[model samples]
Target: MRIRTRGYERRRRELELLIVADIVTIFAWVLGFYGLHPNGHIDFLNPWLTIVVLVPLGAHVANRHLAADADAILLPLATLLNGLGYVMIGVLDPTQAHLQALWTLISVFAYVVCIFFVRNPDSLDRYRYLLAILGIGLLFSPMLPGIGENIGGERLWVHLGSLSFQPVEVSKLLLAIFLTSLLVEKRDLLARLRGGGLRRFGPIALTFGLALAIMAVEKDVGFALLIFVTFVLVMWIGTGNRIYLLFGAVTFVLGLVVGGAVLPQVHQRISVWLDPWKHAATTGYQLIQAQYAFGIGGLSGTGLGLSHPTVPVATSDFIFAAFGQELGLLGTSAIIISFLLLIGAGLRVALRAHGEFSSLLAMTMTIILALQTFFILAGVIRVLPLTGMTLPFLAYGGSSLLTNYILLAILMRISHRSNQFNDLREGTTG
Candidate 1:
């Protein structure tokens, strides 16, 4: 009884710390976000949005502290990283910080509700099934009547009365989670695919073809690459197979060739990367301005509220430019360091998880967030051609913001479980 009491007390304390961290992080982002907004964009909506997002967070974190597996930590960590990104974006563009804060409200609520619904980690597979059904539904949602298409030249979004959602995002997440769960169930079969045999070629071809088809239809080569690369990496991690890695590399190369030939955007991105200044006023304008921000920032930057890099949509697609102009490389480096911390924390949780599902899920979550960040940063830096991924938590998008919140909340729940397990081992509970 004494040991159980101590265990309960220890978990209570850890939950308290989690809550404190959430509050501090939220407050810090709010202040930083407000400080960075462009002039005259201020409004009461920002505070309201922040509350809307955090309220659900408060509920789930409360559950996490109580040692609820249903509460999990995946969402917590995802949100934390996103909030970091959001804060980075917010602090540099005061004008739209309020808008981001507003979107955040709905985003956080969606995430919290999802986390609660998935409380039984054993039942996550069922949730994955439901999500897949909805994901497929959304994947074809744009084809339905009366949805305003043409977001960044991609028909991935569906508009509904003052709101828009990118079905592709939901599809990607559902597909990834579904794939991970399937791979786990068929871990042995998946592991066998790495033998480099001719038999392996068929499955690889199907996977590559299907993924290419999605990206081809979406006209988003970047998203396709992100998904392909993630699958290869995670498969190797899951099954310890070298063939998946090599096969993935070969297929990826083929994909690039096939995609570039058929898609003008794919070719255009490559051309822009080679020489952005050539198309500065049209297709390459965002990148050109982004480069200008980096160049103007130099070593120290123009300082807060002073950069010429605050592009028209600084709170969204070109957010990094705003940071580049305002905070310079030094500030940007700090943001990168924070991202590193979040990744490290995620990896630690995956390594320490108690089950295959937990471990696989945690690792995939890390990979997705890492790849997403890389996708955005690479686009911004011209390492790759441009793609329109909101910089995770930082970009001013409602769906993306909500997605991150769910991610982080799940991470925190995982962390809580790890802590409980540790406390059990230490016999210091209560």
Candidate 2:
């Protein structure tokens, strides 16, 4: 009885937080719309507006019945970020807002489906090899002769009839699952590997090398770097070995040097990062404009949609710059803090997960989210070279939004199972 009451209480708290999120989200929407259309009245009949109000509420209600004891904060945090992102997309590019809204609907539907169906995430370990193969296939799918897309010099998209999407987005999720399952099974062997490090690491390296090679071929240096970092961190955690970490650092540095020397795309990015003014009118025009945007938005902001960011791809890869331009340092700080909180919540879930696989899966997903956020933000600020990647929930891309929502559902499921198991043990003891 006590456990059941506690579960209900947690759900109630989640509801309250979600309500707050919704209020903030709606305000942001109104503010953004107002900034864009100062004299116009909001169209209440818009389906996008309806979705903004209802989706999180609906997800919360579903969780009350389906996953009552899941972490109270994850959904609300996600909702706030997703909502803010949606508003920013509308402000930055009204044309894409409709498409983004449709994607959000589909993504949330997928999230609910995942909650209902994925009862045992650990069971996925049984098909680790198959998942690995599938991930590899997806990674290379864009490289296929006919369907491959060469958009803006990056061969990272695949066109299937009238539809096209980045397969790597889905591949990353599958690969993370495969890596977690493999690590759980091989942690001991990997930990004990002292002298035969090269031989032992060979298989893992080969698999990851293939992934990196494909990314290089596709000119996806950002994802290549992201996955490499994630793999190393997860491997270190799984095996409790610092050797892997050392190896990863050395290899990363070497790869950068070699890539810069050999790959024109990689070389150009590094060169621009080192000195954007050198090509300010041509190659570095986007970064230069982004820097100007930040400079214009000094303290508070120029006001939403008023900055009129001239940076290319301002709606996706450079969305942070757009936010920084309109909302200034304070707004960007709030975003950073939100991400930090989200990452901390994810880590907490991993720590309390019921099994090694669950913990690993949670950790892997969080790492991807954390690193991707860091990489993009750093790139935008010229801390690192720009990596033509979407800013998760904030970016106007169907594939990224869909993949992230699915991952969020899985995280919530793991949290639910973990807490429920704890309740059972306590009840038994009592």
TM-score of 1: 0.83
- lDDT per model vs. reference: 0.67, 0.85
Model 1: CA > 4 A from native: 1-61, 64-96, 126-130, 193-203, 425-430
lDDT of 1 by residue, 103-198 (tens): 676666665675556554545665767876776777767767799476777777789997887766767677777767876886777678445456
Lowest-sum lDDT 10-residue window in model 1 = 69-78
Give the per-residue lDDT digits (tens) of candidate 2, residues 111-155.
899899888889888888898999989988888999999888888
Error of 1 at 27 (Å): 8.8
Which candidate number maximizes lDDT?
Answer: 2
Model 1, C-alpha of 179: deviation from truth (Å): 0.3
